[model samples]
Target chain A: MNTNLYDYAYELEKAMRSSDEFKHLQEMYKSVTNDSEASQMFDEFRNVQMQLQQKQMQGYDITEDEVMRAQEIANRAQENEKVTMLMEAEQRMSMTITELNKIIMKPLDDLYGSMA
Target chain B: MNTNLYDYAYELEKAMRSSDEFKHLQEMYKSVTNDSEASQMFDEFRNVQMQLQQKQMQGYDITEDEVMRAQEIANRAQENEKVTMLMEAEQRMSMTITELNKIIMKPLDDLYGSMA
Candidate 1:
């Protein structure tokens, strides 16, 4: 109920916006958006990720063919300048968020500890 | 790739640990952990949530019986003092995290825009 938490959270959000990770991510994303070829490549990459994630959630194992197909797209994505930059920027930002999540989850972790 | 982001993130993490919301959530969680009945009730409430999530992920619509059972457990959770406080604190903290996530995803949101 205290507004102090919201204040601190908002402050952090603002800080994230000003951070270098967000800046580079924004730049790379814009580069990809302006290029149709790059945009399509990025989209395909994301689709593969989503497909893999869906299969994982359904308790289904991905086939070797699917893995090879995904790898092919990934290799292609990495070869494209805009797509490569965008992916790297995305990973950088994602890593920051992942680290932040661990910090946020500390209390629940404490509760689960041994039981988890 | 920038160290400054890490510095800001760690600063925010430290602030979160010192925030009233985290402190209150910690207290409530500890209270529930120390109480056998309260912990059981909290666990049951979480189980219902996980069950619903699993069903939804599997593309299944929950039956009315399942809905009623979930509601029953939820009602009991709200009635339990320890569970109530812990849940409230969890929601309060979760709201902050959700808001933060929006800020973190701004670049991706911009990239997807109408396509999303």
Candidate 2:
């Protein structure tokens, strides 16, 4: 079995899931629900989640129901553009990580397959 | 009628959900499901998504099923650490957006509540 990819993925997944950045984001998102400000903040988080999910789904098979849900979620975070902008910025950073991972992996696959 | 908070939240949520960064992440995530390289990439995505969801869920009411789901998803992307890393990176980016939203909203809440 090609445990190479499987093992590599597992370790990487562990690192990502455990990273401080990931943990922090989790904390921040939860923070949104803690107080009045927090609830407002959560509204912002929900906005970004909805926006990213919607746009990324552009030519994909996302259902109408999903789109509606996204809209409903977005409506909850509408009052502050500043908060919305901040949320957008963070989402971009997360997307960059995805790009970075792919960039690193292509060569390794070539290297491993050659050895195999 | 303290929709000041509710309205504000709705708009911010809309913005976050609609932002370019959010859209981009969705696109990148879906890209992983398109081909072999993409699948390897997807496993990485699963890792980050799992990590973010799990970590963000800290002190929250996440269930065992969700944790198991996250781990299972992480395993799929184990073939490529690079992909896993990228996925993690993207998730962090998404999470930062949440933080930024909170920062921007707190003051607004204070100002609005005072007005009321």
Using lDDT, give the best candidate's number.
1
Superposed model 1: Cα runs more than 4 Å off: A1-7, A43-79, A111-116, B58-64, B103-116
lDDT of 1 by residue, A1-116 (tens): 54554555556666677788888887888788889999999999999999999987876778999999999999998899999988888888888888867865565576457344
**Model 2: residues with Cα > 4 Å off, grouped in runs:** A36-89, A108-116, B1-116
Going through the candidates in order, the fraction of native interface contacts each one reproduces equals: 0.28, 0.00
Worst 10 residues of 1 chain B by lDDT: B103-112
* Cα lDDT over the full model 2: 0.49
Q: Every model's DockQ, to 2 decimals?
A: 0.28, 0.02
* Candidate 1: tens digits of C-alpha lDDT, residues B1-116: 65655565566666667777778878888899889999899999998999999987876778999999999999998898999989998898788667656764564576457455
The stretch of ten residues in a row with the least summed lDDT in candidate 2 chain B is B1-10
Candidate 2, residues B1-116: lDDT per residue as tens digits? 22232333334444444455445544554454445675655745555576766555442455688767767766666556545644664665446444543443333344334423
**With candidate 2 superimposed using the best TM-score fit, by how many Å does residue B93's alpha carbon deviate from the native?**
27
lDDT of 2 by residue, A9-96 (tens): 3344444444444454445444443446646655555655766566554424556887776667665564545445445545753664
